[model samples]
Target: MEMVDWNLAVATATRLVRPGPEVSREEARDIVAELRRHAKASEEHVRAFTRMEAANPEDADTPVLVVDRPGWVRANVAGFRELLAPLLGKVEERRASIPGGAVLGAVGGKVTGVEVGMLLSFLASRVLGQYETFAPASRELPGATESGGRLLLVAPNIVHVERELDVDPHDFRMWVCLHEETHRTQFTAVPWLRDHIQMEIQSFLGETEIDPSTLLERLREAAQSLTGAKPEAEEGADAEDEPSGESRGSIVELVQTPAQREILGRLTAVMSLLEGHADYVMDGVGPQVVPSVAEIREKFQKRRATGAGRLDQALRKLLGLDAKLRQYRDGERFVRAVVEEVGMDGFNKVWTSPNTLPTKAEIAKPADWIARVHRKAD
Candidate 1:
């Protein structure tokens, strides 16, 4: 099997593919063991990578975070390869230089090899007083709870579909890899991005207030419904259940203060711009490289629509903890218009730095940027 097969296999960790008859407990155990092997291998890969890098590493000299199962790394690398491989052609040196390049598990010896690469990249920037630290978070996995500072961004998609429905898997994967790296690059390029995001979130949370009484009741109800049991009823609930324990016990989320609303509006604009710009670049480059971008985008959206709905809600509630804006499609369209009117170079200028990037007004009305850009150019 290929890389995508491995991806699908790992994801089906607990789920048994029972065909003719019910799967026996032993069979399920074996399947779980197989999945664990991937994790183990990933761990080993990371160790080996660290050693290798220590010997002859990237310029940053920062610690490399190697893993064997970085789904994001794999997907992004495949995407980039799809686009650059055919057009500019493959050159290992140049590929390494791709701002936020990451290698997926199957083709690599380490987990999301490019993750380490990206760390190295940002580390270099940091040395030059670019920023403080890079925030590496986890991917949102269903049923999987988060306890750590950030969710391990390991569960992102690796099984790439063709860029076009008619193309082969290789290009499809490459295109996705490139797409992710594109976002990484944007973040790395804008040093204050990490702080900016955190600041916005903090500001939102600080001002936005929650009703402690109502929130607690809603959460209790949710827990009761999902488990058919309460926390006190279960023995060692942490091990028995997923890790989505309540850091602050409650639900419905507290209401945001007026001051919080101000920050939230700004934060939303920033995220939209980033996400939308990524989609624009990735989608634009799809036809030029991968044949499966359309397929991946279509299936992914469909899946998000059907089953991933809960995750969508859970994420908004947890992260936003307050405000929730559900018009991502509209946001993406607005960003796309800006790019279409000018080009990557022009759009990038807007992101030359936080000061240059679009403010809430510009994002709300991208056409407003037209005047700004013209004024600057003139």
Candidate 2:
């Protein structure tokens, strides 16, 4: 039995997702066309700044898609389904062992689907763009040589954020494209990267030991942890001593075992590198390409720290987006530090192999990564 009704999830998200800013049909088309052009243009700037070219000629031709909120939800649902297939298969195997498991799954699937939909709907408005690394080859645009991945610029979200930030739409769109395009360049330029991340995800899923019986209870604990509500026993403990969920990391970290945490650390490091490197590239390439980049970055940073409202803040904590914000800051710091110590070419050594990539600890201390990778070379 399926644990989530994928179709239901899609329906719920599309029905509940908030509408984007008002725009005429002609205006929307213009926004999309401009975004597509910016995406293509950003690629050249990113490639030039990073000095990392696609390893394969085919990889260079990766598709750039401009999508609306519902379209973004649909694409992500497909990605989540692909990425979670292994874990879902494991759940199925365990369910088959239980006597009433099929019945439970039948009842639970729709509930899970709605919850997934709600989460996606919340995110649908917030994300500006993304590099969908796990995009299925079957979904690749016809005649595309490399089915490696596609870049998605969420048109509605971009328009919403730029208007909210009160920045130049043209510059803001290109700035957003710069960050996302850097991600596409990272994966394409380093042929092994996609496979490396897939292996890590598979490894992490392989280590999952889910129990159908206690799933709800585990989720309850995770929710409590996210909301900063301590159990009754720890209610009197020092608040400062007990770090909040935002500081501790994501719900994923709260639920994992020690071994799984180790794997998570490695994955976190890789993600930080990717996110940080993109931020670095965007800023590095900004002045020449994106005028008013300074105002955009400043406003964007403030907006990230202070979301719309209490409900939005709580959801960001729950979804681990607060941690994502930190990834951009912390990762950018790491990248900046390394580039300062040793020029851009020297920092490029990170993409040489997985072994050269910084560890979780090293992300916090660039000197450690520089010493380990560069000192050895010297």
Best by TM-score: 2
Clashes of each: 40, 0
Residue 224, model 1: lDDT of 52
Q: Which parts of model 2 have CA positions greater than 4 angstroms off?
A: 139-144, 225-228, 236-249, 376-378
* Model 1: lDDT to the true structure: 0.42
- Clashing pairs in model 2, backbone N/Cα/C closer than 3 A: none
Would you give me the overall lDDT of model 2? Answer: 0.85
Q: Write the per-residue lDDT of candidate 1 for residues 38-130, one digit (tens) a residue.
A: 323332232332121111222122211212233333333333333233222223334455554335223532332433343332212111011
Cα RMSD (Å) per model? 18.8, 2.1
The TM-score of candidate 2 is 0.94
Q: What's the TM-score of each model vs. the native?
A: 0.47, 0.94
Best by lDDT: 2
lDDT of 2 by residue, 1-378 (tens): 588888889899999999999999999989989998999998889999999999888879888878888988888888788888888988887887889989988888888899899889999998899888775756532212554588888999999999999999999999999999999999888888888998898888778768754666668876876577767877766635544333432467556677787898899888998999999999899999988999999999899889798778777777778777878888999999999999999999999999999999999999999989988643
